[model samples]
Target: METVSGHRPTIIDVAKRAGVSKSTAARALAGASNISDSAREQVLRAADALGYTRNALAVGMRSGRSGMLGLVLPDIANPFWGEVARGAQDRAADADTSILIFSSNRCARKELMHLSTLMRARVDGAIINSVADSLDDLDRFGLPCILIGSSAERFPDTCSVGSDIVQGVGLGMDYLRSMGHERPALIVGQPTRLARARFLRVVHEHCVEHDIDPAVLLIENADYTVEGGRFAMQRLLARNHGLLCVFAANDLMALGAMSAVREAGLRCPEDVSILGFDGIQAGAFAWPGLTTIEKPARQIGAQAVAWLLDGNADAKPGTRVHLPCRLIERGSLANLCDASARRVGSVKG
Candidate 1:
């Protein structure tokens, strides 16, 4: 990546190219305020031609507030987290804030370290979807924070915005149960508060009340990754005979489970009905267009900001807020007595 002069183009060169002062170029490139539109366009074009990237660290330090928010998510590649990031960024921009993003990949120690780094930066605020398994692990954030997909009960003073896991799983169970899926398989999330463990508890309770076996096969925990979900589904299919439906904790795992079903020579909703949580865009585009629970991610993100900035003097330190999860029926489910079921029955006969 060499320039024609065999030297990297500097900020001065950008200013000269754009016919603007050094200060003006610097401000425009850093997204500073009060710069004329025409001048800003010139600087942007000049920077583009020079292939310039701003030194955010230096700029961030100069501005005490960083005008930035730190977002810590379990996995950036996951669509659900991607939506969270989208919502966070959209709202932060509205508030004239920037975002510094990081992915924990569901490691507790890594998440804590990231929080510490954000605190050190004196970030205006942090939006975290942490996988901390205990209160001690979550207590590390000594800054204004909003926890997405985590409970307010765990962190008293912190603001939380999460989809109702209990209700989401219950929606899936209710649909499956109504479809006559008496022997459904379950893919539990990794035993963290928001992702896996709570949903499992809700479904387990539903099973017991309905007089279904509380201990069914293919029930296991994994990181909320596609590969993890696929592996879990494979293990479940091998161990669970006569299973009619599979409920995944998240959309990624649900899509992975669909792959596993296809690999087992089964078709969705016909041979086996699969349901998932997190009504992300990718799920709607899935081959069978996954049936799932819709989480109001953008709404949650915006409202979380409202809560944190509410400036309520009497607001309790830790107030838990749970958003409702709405069931979305789609192409991935069918009654056990449907044509696919009859096909399986004929094969067995």
Candidate 2:
């Protein structure tokens, strides 16, 4: 057949070459069972000869599926979020779908704006790791969503996948206690009420279990940024210079806190032990590798996409999937008794 304007061959060209109707050619190319095998074979042969390619946009328009997923993160700059994004991207690729990621900068207003944009784009579904107080607004979007991390509990109507924060905190606190640190402080992330509250409750309960005075527990809030961690650590030092250890909510903050310790002429694991949550890769390269609770951030991200695309359709509202975290020992943490003995020996000399 003569080409029209010498442009790439279209499905229409394939239809004509195969001696079949346009609908039959389209259905055959799509592998629809209703089309006879003979017709399907003819369409396939014609498509190969004409070099005809299917248009994803046209397919989406006809099927009512955009084949796109949305990922909303509080802060993409953080390595933890990067790991999560990688996981989501890998999973989306496996499903032959695309992912569009948006960062909210941990702001409620910006998060709403991103969600609105995604809705206008008609994404098939979304996975949000939001710091916003309420997820009730999400219902208005009418899109399937899966909450990541603590936000999952805040919105019971959506499916969620995350590490068990309570268990993670407990594991960290218990490890510190075993190492001989009694007066350990906590440096938490931005003021997300539920997450902050859960971490504090776990810290307090851990203190009580160890017979450590709850009143002596020092708690400070940072923006979950490196600088925020540095400032929070400085403030903690200013208020209580005798603290033997500190636990940060995430790794970036932990690294910052360690920097603050060095600025104050103190050494990690020797002068003041440090522990962190979220086992981001950067932690392994820190001055004294961070001792942290390793959350399966990548796994969580991948699972969120799976739930949104394959599972959420049949899952009951408010379904939560909690993954476990493990403790990673590194140079940053030291046994309290060992630290004390060294200090006493130096004083005597």
Candidate 3:
């Protein structure tokens, strides 16, 4: 049956075209087991011919279960977040759902606004990577929500999915120690972020375990951008001339710090070694390449989707999932132990 003018094609139209009852066409389109193979094929073929498609929104409204998710991120421009968003989108597609993404740009008001919009849109659940605690709004709305990254730890009793920052920092520190780099400085996020304190704690613990006093260590904050990293590196350089290596909170900052080292008439790995976190692809192609701690960013995104949509009660709220991280060795870090051995041999000769 041809669709009437100014009207969208529906299952009725498909049924008329396929010479079947409306109920039979619906069951055939829905892949119901009761539908015969001949009827199913006819319904599918008729739907194709009439350009008929199921209205998921109508179906969801009638069933009171829309398969839509909301994802809110601090900065979508960052490559790390890009990978996370990609993973989430892919996973949502697999689950026959859609994701509505919003970038809050680390603004609390913006985050609230986006959350409100998601609620108004009737999304089933939300995945939020926040800058501040967002639990109160959650209680008010009574919607299922999950937090990602540092803010998740701050708010107890919320489901969160994130990579292990502690393990990542530990890998960087241990590798630095093995390379014989003692005076390692830190380029971290601003003090407002819970992540800054988290990184500081890990580095301080590492130094204490290695018998190095934490007070003497250099620590500066950056905006997780290249320019921010450059400025932070300049400040750290001004305070210390014997900087052997610097570990940045992310790869972009590390790349910027590397440029700052060169601007100071020094060479990477020769004068100042740099280590980065967040194992982005650009780190592999950087000049002298960047040694970084690889976070499972994609897994973080996908896992959040999985847990959010889980109908089972096993993944309870306030459950925090911390995935592991590892080190990616590259040329940015100098092997001072090897250089020291060569220096000793030359002096003896």
Question: Per-residue lDDT for 11-125 in model 2, tens only?
Answer: 8899999999999999998879999999999999999988787886678777877788899998899999999999999999999889999999878899989899988777888
Measured by C-alpha RMSD in angstroms, how accurate is candidate 3? 3.9
In TM-score terms, which candidate is top? 3
Local distance difference test, each candidate: 0.75, 0.84, 0.83
Against the correct fold, how does model 1 do in TM-score?
0.74
- Stretches off by above 4 angstroms in model 3 are 1-6, 31-34, 312-315, 340-349
Q: What pairs collide in candidate 1?
A: 156-317, 156-318, 157-317, 157-318
**Candidate 1 vs 3: which has more TM-score:** 3
Residues 1-349 of candidate 1 have per-residue lDDT tens digits of: 3467887777888899999999999989877888999999999998998897665566777765566678888788878777777877787778776778899987878888888888887776677775676656555555567777754445666667787777777877888877777656777766644545577778779988888878863576766767777888788767646645778888888888888878877778667778888898888888899999888777776666665555321264556678888988888877765545443221010
Sorted by TM-score, highest first, which candidate order results? 3, 2, 1
Give the C-alpha lDDT of model 2.
Answer: 0.84
What are the clashing pairs of model 3? 1-17, 157-318, 158-318
Residue 342 C-alpha lDDT in model 3: 23
Give the lowest summed-lDDT range of ten residues in model 1.
340-349
Ranking by lDDT: 2, 3, 1
List candidate 2 segments past 4 Å from native: 1-9, 14-21, 35-53, 311-314, 337-349
Residue 195 error, candidate 2, Å: 1.9
